[model samples]
Target: MSLFAKRIVLGVSGGIAAYKAPDLVRRLRDASAEVRVVLTQGAQAFITPLTFQAVSHQPVHTDLLDPEAEAGMGHLELARWADQIVIAPASADLLAKLAHGHANDLLTTLCLATEAPITLCPAMNHIMWQAPATEANIHTLETRGVRLLGPIEGPLAEGESGPGRLMEPLDIVAALNGAAGAVPSIAALSDKRVLITAGPTREPIDPVRFLANRSSGRMGFAIAEAAARAGAQVTLVTGPSQLTAPRGVTRVDVETAEQMHREVLARAAQADLFIAAAAVADYRVAAPADQKVKKTETAQHLELVPNPDILRDVAALSDGPFTVGFAAETQAIVDNARRKLTDKGLDLIAANAVGEQQGFDVSDNTLQVLWSDGQATLGPAPKTQIASELIELIGARLDATG
Candidate 1:
């Protein structure tokens, strides 16, 4: 398969494998890719920019503040220039920065600015790679749809054989080829209409303010993307979030719980499957102020009224789609999910813990899925991976029952 004229941004971070970056650039070039090199500050200590420039025959981008770069918009320029990004020797620090959305350097900044798919070939010591924090960061990156090539099991720079070695240059090239659609595809949900809800609904408190939850909508968005990849006709009804729509899916934006309810109910009749992934607000202001509520000396007691339950409403439909619901709970996860699955007339329910670190705004998640006759556990992975697994399960159940 030809990768002719593909624009590739290869990032070299600090590690002993930094020396191998030039070889990686050469391999990409041999595949007919136009490659640009971005050297992290630590990478400069191991492999000089001159070596990369000499090998790739292109200017190496390192500094985030270079003035000569496209009118001092160097980072933005590089971000927009790439079709794909491959970061080899992705250090622990770099991974942490990416996981937490830090953009202190050009590499991390470009990763954030670019719309391109990212592939990270992590190179770290075994202990560091296996550390809880590092694994968490890796999970976060994966959840955000950043593809990881291995820190495969092999000899490490410390002369100890274990996981953490970067994948070989040629192997990396093959992975890149697979990413570019040269590999055979999975069409599990072909021709199925999958309707999904996502993100946290915002309940207005006033004209200028609202109440919302901590949901990042990552899990829901991940499911939508996975369903699209599975060749399902997907419609995403999302609340306020900064996420982009997945390929081949339609997105309908809504805010308050009532708005999401209307959108989901309007489209639920046409769907073959319905996944209620949104963290819709349970309550809203009984009567929102027409103007911004003025701060008062006396404490104000805002009254809250229960919002319409979108999941229950959809599941109550006479011939509704096979419905799935999500229960993000702090305790009794399985019991609660099972109860919801029954009470809401859902075909399936997924339960997970939500706290400061485990769920909600965090990158990775774990799930316990419950259905009338079966169950599955997933995650402690990138939410995208979890979504992929969950979508497969959904497909299987549909196939079995259909």
Candidate 2:
């Protein structure tokens, strides 16, 4: 039942991962999908059109204007022929072009002409993948209902390892099988306003130095995306992180804990739900040196002061939003989370154990969610999947309370 008889237009973009496109075509056909391959000029640098043509058993389309095919508008013909369009090894350049609606090439032009759903499997250097511009482009694509499969974490072509690898050919086929039947859920948060805080806030130590934590903000960003998909008007107050704001979500970037606190409280009144997910610094320098502190032979002592309790403050508001808080613990996870839940007067709290191996700067997560009456445990799965499940739970609990 996986992509059987589906007409898939396979777009190959420029990247080292282009070498895997032929295998991807084979896998798609193995799942009984009819695949037509398209190649960009840059893609031709890594793999030839003939190679794809041989594997797909179909002519590989490359040019925007063809004397033989343009007489009948070949791009339009291919555009109208597809049931779905998939770009494997979607380069950062391709993404930016698509995001900005550039149709100078055959593939981009076909994408503009097609009415079928589009899916992208991004592959790039780890640093490039995490770039702010790339993040914004991805966010734009997601909002336009373009699905993304992966830029999963793994070894890159340059011998560095991070989240820029293309999903394996077999894995892509398996995922497409699942994606083929997937439908958007009901708009559970329709007309609702959601405020979420994410990432680790910094506390300035000197002009060039700062105290920060390992929070990458992936979990919070995923939750924001899930909430947006559920039709909520989401405002994300995020600390400094490489991840961008999700599509259809408004992003407010801050650096210090105080800035995050200010932004969250400013918008908390208008929100229907609030998720305090930021790993904010518990303390900051009482009076940090105005200039860079010079290294000396003697020890340096910094006077630290407690930071504002953001979750508790928001919860204490009169007729405020239904507040949810997150607790990342090293030991006594549940006990600490439960304490925070009650102490902060939160409607619900999600807690997880964090150490060198789990949580913090990672892509996957496991959560123990607790409300006053009941509790649930969510998977040690990809953060995106966890976010989806967590959102479903949030929507159900919100309904129950009302």
Candidate 3:
């Protein structure tokens, strides 16, 4: 779960992407969010209110003029009920309506009446999205403080494609989770420099061969995003990965374990917090061929040498930052994590089980956080939720120690 449970009202508008509503509701619930669905009349053309009701385990609101609810001003009631109003698949028509403050429908009426922040995930044809009126309407909504998620440029439902496709349900969830209840002007980690290492470091055996792990860097990148959200001056020292850097983060890209170590050591003194989340290869080929080695008739012997202990070196610094380490073990998680806490002189260690289908290349992860005095288990959920909880925990610990 996130640090706080959110009461989210998900409004689905008329678009081909309305088919994704069920999965969006499921994801919100999976993150421990309370979800209620609001469907527009045109949305019923694609998905039924009954289908949404089944997945949400609640009645879906459709009619703007329901006799029973209208008796108590239903739109106003729902507007007050939401902590945030997220309209996914927000069509061009709906955007225009909301921008002009039209209350012809339930969703637009709720947008007008709600004090909660409005987030729109615009989904429409590229031509409609690029029109002068639509662009002006979006700017109008933005000026009124409405947050726009994405119409990420990619393939579209229409044969001709440009921009204006709705983001994936998971990406929407991540953006919502990142923005929910976020204070507009709090200096939570302000001016505090944070350096985080993420992803899998490659150790080259030859020109065409290298050693690496399955680390996707989702958790580490989530941490960087969360830290930045709290107003930290964040520097993400990352290994080679396809992931983009989080907004407002400085990414220092590196490849080999030696490169990561050099960067971390160089940046440690200036950081207030140092998180070693990269799955650096522990060993590398001692001697390598200048070129790609060809298959030999005889059995080949390869020498291996240990890589530098990046975390241990950082912890041993005279003026080191609050050092954190990750222990990915197959068994005896707590014991191994506790041992590493002392062995590496880490201020904190987050332990997880690796191998099989868990923890390495997945979007969701769990963590057992171990410190000298106590421990806390943080998962069985998405990495985004876990990351928020972890940041909150770190903030609390820093306060306690201070």
Candidate 4:
């Protein structure tokens, strides 16, 4: 139910995502939950205990051996104190330690000693996440009744992208609270057929290379999941992504923008809703080499041609499904979103500013949602949480219109 008075022992392990742990503490406190933090030795390199202390308004713990703490029985006391133990940025190393019964550190020791429910929000590189060792450890933890939130797909701290980004602070809080009965599922899209697109469409340059964007398809997949959970029969026409299709949703995999266009239009007529979340290439090489092109000393230019405007095309359909569009803008986010909302004849549009630090490849994003006569700002939170809110709004609007 409410996080009110709930005691949450947040374990921050060594990982780039550990920086987000302080914000998580604030979110917990905002929800009226009492939070105590435990940082692994590796975690301290990324963030200091003082940061957690300031946000949590409590002392930070990092050692299994503390002479000042309950005469060196501190780990057991913390174990007894918690109603829940949440490990955000649960590094691959920590997961293994927990799985194999390692208790060398205070966090691991507390986990072994505690009877409280444990939830882990795993954060690491996508490759590591897909590793057999990690998979086996996850399976073990799940069988032992441990809960996992996400190492959701998106850009990572390293200059690469995939699933491994930590769940955002508010998102983790929402999930924790939701599981505790703070929120209930709504069958808002019950019996509705929903069509969605996700990820980045790749336009061929040659057999060996292509043009693509930074979209990881996380937002689209999340919407597919949330919509499915809300009782919609969803078909996700996704571009290249490592994410598996959400449970209970149908999946259609495609690559280039042309392919995505074909797939969505072919199924659009049967849908009750269409969400165009893919970052489809606006243009493609006019002529692609049949074989890989040879590098030359002189610079070369590519002849580009415009790709089909899938959103505009869908929105133009007579009596089409309630159409929703996404606008990824580099500037003037609200104005651009509003213009697209009107110009494209979209029922609704969600826009966000995307750049090096925001939107495109990252796990967390903010949406400027616009319609004919109304607007709302959602997030600056996790894409999954934003998807849930947007789906709820879509359902309400759909009901109002009908």
Best-fitting candidate, scored by TM-score: 3
Reference-based TM-score of each model: 0.60, 0.72, 0.77, 0.66
Give one digit per residue, the lDDT tens place, for model 2 in 265-332. Answer: 99989899999888999999999889999999999999999999899999999989999999999999
User: Which pairs of residues collide in model 2?
Assistant: none
Model 1: per-residue Cα lDDT over 288-345, one tens digit each = 9998889979998889999999999989999999999999999999999999999888
The best candidate in terms of lDDT:
4
User: Candidate 1: what lDDT?
Assistant: 0.85
Separately for all candidates shown, the number of backbone clashes (residues 3 or more apart, or on different chains) is 0, 0, 0, 1
- Scanning candidate 3 in windows of ten residues, the lowest lDDT window is 181-190
Please give the lDDT score at residue 346 for candidate 2: 96
- Stretches of candidate 2 exceeding 4 Å from the true structure: 1-10, 17-44, 48-85, 91-116, 121-144, 148-186
> Candidate 4: global Cα-lDDT?
0.89
Candidate 3 matches the true fold with a TM-score of 0.77
Q: Which ten residues in a row have the lowest lDDT in candidate 2?
A: 178-187
Looking at candidate 2, what is the lDDT of residue 1?
Answer: 31
* RMSD per model, one decimal: 15.0, 6.0, 5.1, 6.2
- Name the better of 1 and 2 by TM-score: 2
Tens-place lDDT digits, model 3, residues 230-254:
6688999999876656646899999
